[model samples]
Target: MSERSFEGKAVLVTGGSRGIGAAVARRFGSLGAHVAVGYRSGRDAAEALCAEIGAAGGTAVAVAGDVAVPAQAQAMVGRAHDAFGRLDVLVNAAGVGPYLPLAEIDEAHCRAIFDTNVLGTIMLTQAAAPLLPSPGGRIVHFASRLAFNPLPTSSVYSASKAAVVTLVHGFARELGPRGITVNAVAPGVIETDMTADILRERGEQILAATPLRRIGQPDDVAGVVTFLASADAGWVTGRTIIADGGLN
Candidate 1:
């Protein structure tokens, strides 16, 4: 695809302050899309990313909001539209890790994971649907390798991601008539802060399981997302593109 394939488009990435979210935001911005970086915290990191994009001559704005809340999710979409006049793509990349056993999973942990990973995706998609132009719009959600095969202490996180995959299918079906595509990327063992602790502890085990013998990175998944968001993926929708380094 041309470097300017996404030029004149508007893209929004939630939880884009750091890690995978940050990478996704930058990738889209670099493609000439007016990007919106949505964050719940890490104001400094968010601001720095926006500045970096600006310095690179990419259009970007950092918007702070919690995805778990409906109002906040709406606000994120609103801000993206307000900034760029339209929203051509919405990427739900905001997520949290809760690596506890099923027995140890409490109400709070379950609620938090579900609210942000599931409900937040729905709310954000709904808010951006109208802004998506007919015949060319995309919605990408983040899933995990654990959705296919869960680890011992990651039941909650795995379940939440599984829900995301399910939502992707349903949304794609619902939006197909309008020419909107919905999909997901299931990444494995990315080198990010959220999994820093896990990597330090189980890096070897993960590497051994992955056929590539390496952990995935934010850009590894971001590349796939960028593809799904582009015109090249016009016929792709309601699909989960797994980027797990052959771990599963």
Candidate 2:
């Protein structure tokens, strides 16, 4: 693809301050898309990323909001649309994963994971639907390999991601009539602060299991997301593209 394949596009990426979200935002910005980097807490990181993109001749803005909240999701979408005059892509990357056994899962734990990983995605997509132009808009969500591979001590996280996959399917059908395509990327063992502890604890085992014998990186997943957001993926929808290095 050309460096400016996404020229004139505007994208709102929740959790764009760090990890996979940060990589996705930067990738889109570098491809000439105006980006709105939404962060729940990492204001400094978000602002820094926006500045870096701007300095590189890309347009971007730092948007602060919690995707888990309906009001904040609305405002975040509104701000991005107001800034760019339209919306073309929505990347739902904000999520929390607390690895815990099923026996230890509690109401609070379920609420936290589901609210952010599932509800937040739905809310933001709903908020951005009207802004997205028919026959061209895209929605990309983040899932996890664990959703299907399932492992010990990841009940809540896995279930939440499974929910995301189901949501993508439903939304793809519902939005297809509007010419919007919805898809997801399921990553495995990505190297990010969120997964640092797991990588340290099970790095060898993960590598051994992966056919590629390597842990995934944020950019690895970002590339798939960029594809789903591009015009090349116009006919693709309701699919979860896995970026797990063949770990599953």
Candidate 3:
């Protein structure tokens, strides 16, 4: 694809204020796409990203809403559509991954993870699917490597991501006739705020196991997302790209 291949496209990235979501938004913005940076709480970060994109000769807006809430998720997509008039891509990157042992995993904790990771993806897709242009719509979701290789504390979080992988298959088939592709990226141990503690505690151990001999970065995963959203991936759907730096 050309450097500015996404020119004239509009993207809405949930959880776009920081981490992988922010990188995805920036990638889209740099490629000439208008972006909607959706965030649940990081208003300052979200607006700053928008300002940065605008200063760099791109268009972006900070949209605030809780993806875990169905009404809020719909309204968030609606807000993005209002900002750009059309939605070409929907990136569902909003998620939580707090780890807890099975014994300590209460109903509240499990619900929180599922509500955000699973339900949020569904609600956002439902809202954006109609607005996306037929024969070219793209939906990229953020799953996790834990869904494939789980740790003891990852019981709940892994289950949530597994649900996402299943949804990708189901939604892709449901939306295939419309030419809207649904897919996911499962990242492993990316160096983001979400993984700082894990890296600090076991960075060396992880690097030793990873064939790439290093940790993953937000941009590393972001590139995969943008590809899935780009024209090159038109015939690809219901797939999960593993972005683990070969750790698994």
lDDT, each prediction: 0.91, 0.92, 0.94
Over 4 Å off in model 1, which ranges?
none
Most lDDT-accurate candidate = 3
In candidate 3, how many Å is residue 27 off? 0.4
Clash counts per candidate, in order, are 0, 0, 0
**1-248 per-residue lDDT for model 1 (tens digits):** 78888899999999899999999999988889899999998889998999999899899998889999999999889998999999899998999987887678789999999999999989999998988999898999999989988889988889899999999999999999999999999988899999999989989988888999778889888889999999999999999988988884
Largest TM-score belongs to which candidate? 3
Candidate 3 residue runs with Cα over 4 Å from true position: none
For residues 1-248, could you state the per-residue lDDT of candidate 2 as single tens digits?
Answer: 78899999999999999999999999999999999999999999999999999999999999989888899989999999998999999998998987888788899999999889998989998998888999899999989989997889998899899999999999999999999999999998899998999989989998899999788889988889999999999999999998889884
Query: Please, what are the lDDT tens digits per residue for candidate 3 over residues 1-248?
Result: 68898999999999999999999999999999999999999999999999999999999999999999999999999999999899999999999999998789899998899999999989998998999989899999988999988988989999999999999999999999999999999999999988998999999999999999989999998889999999999999999999899894
Order of candidate numbers by lDDT, starting with the best:
3, 2, 1
Model 3 is weakest, by summed lDDT over 10 consecutive residues, at: 239-248
Q: Residue 36 in candidate 2 has what lDDT?
A: 95
